[model samples]
Target: MASIKAQAHHQRVRIRGYDVDIRTYGAGARNVVLVHGIGASGRYFSRLVDLLAQTCTVHTLEMPGFGSAPKPSHSLDMAGFAAVNCDALRAAGIGPAQWVGHSMGCQVVTEMALLAPDLVTSVVLLSPTINRGERNAVLQGLRLAQDCLREPPAVNWMLLTDYLRAGPRWYLRTMPKMVRHRLEQRIGGVEVPVTLIRGGRDPIVPARWLQELAAARPGAVAVELPGQPHVCMFTEPARTAALLREAASGQ
Candidate 1:
């Protein structure tokens, strides 16, 4: 992938009564949408965006209640979150493209694909969350802490600061929907191709969970990058970008 030479286009558009910030990178024919997790902003995909911009137009969506976006009047469930993103993309004059998401963002994209299949060409989920076997928030938090030990300081710092930026009120209010979302069941509804990528050492999404996720769809493919933790997109951008490229290429 070529280094990102083009400047990104940053703008805020209204979506469901809230101003949603979205960044567009490159002017390539193919469209690639990047969705951050619950606590993270679209900025988390800076490196991956640079890589994907080489051959695809990358769109980073900063969901309402996260990043610099203002919180909504009330918490939105998974479907509501997807609807907001879909509406934002449409309002921005962007059409269907490859969808890439990290952690809770995976749930969001999966929901989007289900809600607007015509708007999603494919999907790539990184470190997807709320493993069916371990859906409780407390246990997942403990597992995330354990996984953090293996992550680099910069990765943990980014995660911590992003979580702080999101604030407890919003995170706590929105987390239940993420945990309760039937992502495993919902994945089956996505007719477009799906690719599931997990850090080999990611505690939040284990091997069995990845397998089950892949098994949910007849054409889904699961990839594991050993020794990488939950935020591999930050710590291992090259590998993550390469996998994303392959997924976007439909390889």
Candidate 2:
């Protein structure tokens, strides 16, 4: 949870046209949007927004089926998520802004860049998951399914209380769609400047994938946090904010 001071400085905006719930902070000319990963919400970027607000106007978006927004009625996939984000950005009057996404948010950012390249100035991907490969990808999906099945309802309650708040059935039904999403092709099509941040200790996404993405992009840089994990954005908001500032400034 973010401090009271941080939340006080941020403004909540509802964009009905896009069906988005957005948090806006600071008054800087440079605008930046933060997108959280699966089973998370805009609240995850509270600290990062606090840090970046000094030099950038930060916007954090809660997807249709997450955070305070209503659960999506239609079948939701990466593309659907991207479209909603795009509509939200437009409704919020954000144009050609720097986009920062973490984990599953990275995938959404990729899809947005592909879907509306002209609207994106640059992208910062945190712990992006790409190229799952044939064998390992299937195994990972199966493992996630098994874990979902084997874990006690209490464990699920403890870990995903926020998600449950959005809607248990919605979360359960959307879980499989997220696991099956593949963004390799869309990621390869990105032409804007990209900076990838990876937690060295993150087990979910390997360093090899980060390296590959960096190699593929025309102007992509990958940075690995020395002793961080999947939640590095929350665990290391200051460091992540610095990287985001650098990328936003075109450094």
Candidate 3:
């Protein structure tokens, strides 16, 4: 189990007429923003937040329809979701922070970097999802199941619980958008530094795809955690947090 930090707290703020929930931790000079994947909430980043909070101010978002954030009147597409998060960040007085995202969260942050370059210092994509080559939902599900088999039971539980909390209807509604976004095109437009972190055993995000994603962008860096599974950040918070700190510091 990961150590719990006493400093973590939740903040509710409205952005673009939608209520956004942010979990904040630590109070260091640097700012780090965490974006959770589809069917997930800020709670998914609990361990990572606790670790990073030790050295940097960290803000993890519950992207509108997920976690405790109220469900919107209508579902927002990938870009729309990213835009809302951008507004939430600005409203919270954050500017140019290191953006760290997990799974589908990577698409959200990547879209944010493209839409509002000045607001992002850098980007970290952890076990990024929806590989363009295998966008079919059935195929993705199979790969996810395969990856889950390798991940620890705790990580699988965390994922299942978060997915249930996100609700099946909303997750299904958001699936197409996540699959259709052209990450290759979008990533090409991001000028800030980008880092790709993936578990060596992540079936959803294969090593080849990670390499391809990094290659698509001029200076993007790809880091793989050998023997790790899809939810590497959740299972290896200390090591992952240190890598994030290094990426944030450009080390």
Candidate 4:
């Protein structure tokens, strides 16, 4: 099933001045952490949340400056963001499970795996963004605009709401930090198992980048879901959840 009417228990964790909002679902043994991309909230992955809830406990995190989490005093670099987020999650007793991230969230979790190695046992990167080949604001914006033409209305609406909530100042302030990170280079530093996934139709993350990332890591798994957009987890929650379930199974 692509979705289910699962109940989410919301809670806020305050760690080292960072307020983290987490929505918990399911009571299964396997645990999965869902981290949304830049300018997005946990709601972006609601479909996947519900689907995964059926078979595993899902922790949907709203990072600082987006969603329910309060904005920070200043924009943080990838490493800084990773430290704050991982500290909060670890404080909340979450870790040693599959840490899945999308867009810039992918960079954050990968950094977390390196900084707080104990908190992340495995990492799943979905449509990781700011391709080193096209890392400028103009190019990134153009790619996003192009992808919008193919996105479903619901997906666009969700993004609209989340973007508004994040506000332009914060989003712009963090944009450069995201573009500056070298995810392809950092992925190599991650000691834990890593899985790379992307929607086949995603323009922001090209297939060549995914292949390059996989090639650099001998054991990494790369998957491409046909006919899906950047937010494939929302469009094909059941299919993505199956991939996640397989990832979590090894944990």
By lDDT, who's the top model here? 1
The Cα error of candidate 4 at residue 17, in Å, is 2.2
* Superposition error at 32 for model 2 (Å): 0.6
The per-prediction CA RMSD against the true structure, in angstroms, equals 2.0, 4.5, 1.7, 1.9
Residue 122, model 1: Cα distance from true site in angstroms: 0.7
Per-residue lDDT of candidate 4, residues 1-251 (tens digit):
23343467788887667778988888888788888889999887888887778778889888888997999787788888888888878787886678999988998888888898777767889998767789899999999988898889988998999999999999999999999998878888888788899999999999998898887666889999998889988888888888877766564
Worst 10 residues of 3 by lDDT: 1-10
lDDT of 2 by residue, 171-229 (tens): 66666666677755567788778899987776666788788777777568889987766
Q: What does candidate 4 score on TM?
A: 0.95
lDDT ranking from best to worst?
1, 4, 3, 2
lDDT of 3: 0.84
Residue range 1-251, candidate 1, lDDT tens digits: 22452477788989659777888889889998989998888766877877777778888988998988888888888888899999999889887888888999999999998888888888999999889999998998899889889988877787799889889999999989899998889899888889999888898899999999999887998999988888878778888888877787783
Instruction: Give per-model TM-scores.
Output: 0.95, 0.82, 0.95, 0.95
TM-score of 3: 0.95
lDDT of 4 at 89: 81
Better of 1 and 2 by lDDT: 1
What's the lDDT for residue 78 in model 2?
79
Candidate 4's C-alpha runs over 4 A off are 1-6
